[model samples]
Target: MSYKTIVVHLDTSARAQARLHLAIEIAKRHGAFLQGVFAVFAPNPRSFVVMAGTAEYYEEHETVRHEEHGALERLFEAELSRAHVDGEWIDETGNADDELPKYARRADLLIIGQDDPADPESFVADHFPENMVMSAGRPVLVVPYAGSFAHIGRRVMVAWDGSREATRAVHDALPLLKQSEQTTVVTISAAHGNVPGARPPGADIAATLTRHGVKVTTLDLPAAKDVATGEMLLARIDDIGADLVVMGGYGHTRWQELILGGVTRTMLSSMTVPVLMSH
Candidate 1:
């Protein structure tokens, strides 16, 4: 489907310009309506933790929060001023991971930065992919902090798992796939040594893409590294010099703090190109 209303999850960090640039290009490429989103805590998440602090402390917290909101808005405004495409700005004050998807569930796509969680300052896991993907069920395009993508159609990579979420990510990314000069479907081990029948039905997928007139190529490789499939995909993306990588978002969280076997977490940390994914 063509993206008409794309929502980008903007991390309010000093280096957020790269994320904004990629989002602008995607929006223009699809002629899509776009919105820049920043997650915030409503009633403040810190209120629960900092209750015992002095009045002066709470005032400082509130001031800092207000300034953050303002800074985010201005940053986006500046980016949009340089962007050839036009879009709206959005800010939601609440627990970031919770607030984003809860309000913008039906958006055509979600774009966010892919930064490491261990850096003590990465936005990838720190923001809210876990909650957003599980709830929104919309594709998320994750870009590494050192972004360098301009247009996404030169060469494309699709990481296929044949699961429901993977299926969703692929279909959601079809618009870009169709526009790509070449597209490769890279699937991790389907058997996993456990289920001989675990592989995705391939001929049907090839037929489906053929119907779209997509220049599609398919390869199912054995799991080679200790790295998760998502990480493998991004590694291949860089190796292939791909402009865009498409894959399914695997895994979900129970409650708020726990996560399961999703490859998204790893991909986000190390990716260097633009990636399109759906939950």
Candidate 2:
């Protein structure tokens, strides 16, 4: 449950530096190895609109992608040298959604930049959190578009659903939770969904964590009035003054490479704190 290795998905977007800074900060704080991964989307031949005059321009633009990969490696190496942190750099060619998770499989935690919708080339445009959560089946620490995080586990909030995704997130977050100065398991539902005969049915989920030596609090939020679970979770996260929020990635497949998932899109749109998600 100790986080000694972290994989951060790097990209060539404007947000790249912010993401890099946060990852390095976390690695230093935890004494963890930083695995820097830059994902390149296989240029879509079909998506290119054939243009006679622009043919050369398009080819030149594409060439830059390759060179940019190399430049990123050099940049990260320089930065890591200054920080005195050992890290490996990788430039993987494929759909970031597919390739990033494969490399993330062995990491204690995965870090990704929260993409800006304004940027057409944002890697997060692929709805990666959904795929990463499902495929990587690990805790993902997502840095929001702006503020960076320091030591994440000092105080935390857990959004509990008792679903497999939520369960996986809890297990994946055990390392952080165990280190937290305080951890709260908050379950919001119009009605209780605990399994029958589960002890501390006041959402015994919180009690289970208490048994693990976590300074824990469980709140069965009855005001679960909102059908929008994402909003509820965010509101509660604010209430707790927690810097980190841990929850399951919730999604229902909308189409191939598309998910109209509730909480998935909600957090993507706006989140108040850093979120650690698992599918």
Q: Clashing pairs in model 2?
A: none
Q: Summarize candidate 1's per-residue lDDT along 3-44 as a digit string, tens digits.
A: 888887765454466667777888888888789877533344
Q: lDDT of each model, Cα atoms only?
A: 0.68, 0.75
Ten residues in sequence with the least summed lDDT for candidate 2: 194-203
Superposed Cα deviation of residue 159, candidate 2 (Å): 0.2
Residue-level lDDT tens digits of model 2 in 21-115: 77887787678899998884555655566756565666886788667767778888988888888889886666788778777888888998676
What TM-score fits each model? 0.78, 0.83
> Per-prediction count of colliding residue pairs?
9, 0
The TM-score, computed over Cα atoms with residue i paired to residue i, of candidate 2 is: 0.83
- Report each candidate's C-alpha RMSD, comma-separated, in the order given: 4.2, 3.3
| Regions of candidate 2 where Cα sits further than 4 Å from its true position | 45-49, 59-71, 191-203, 224-227, 252-261
Off by over 4 Å in 1: 41-75, 78-84, 116-127, 189-203, 224-231, 255-257
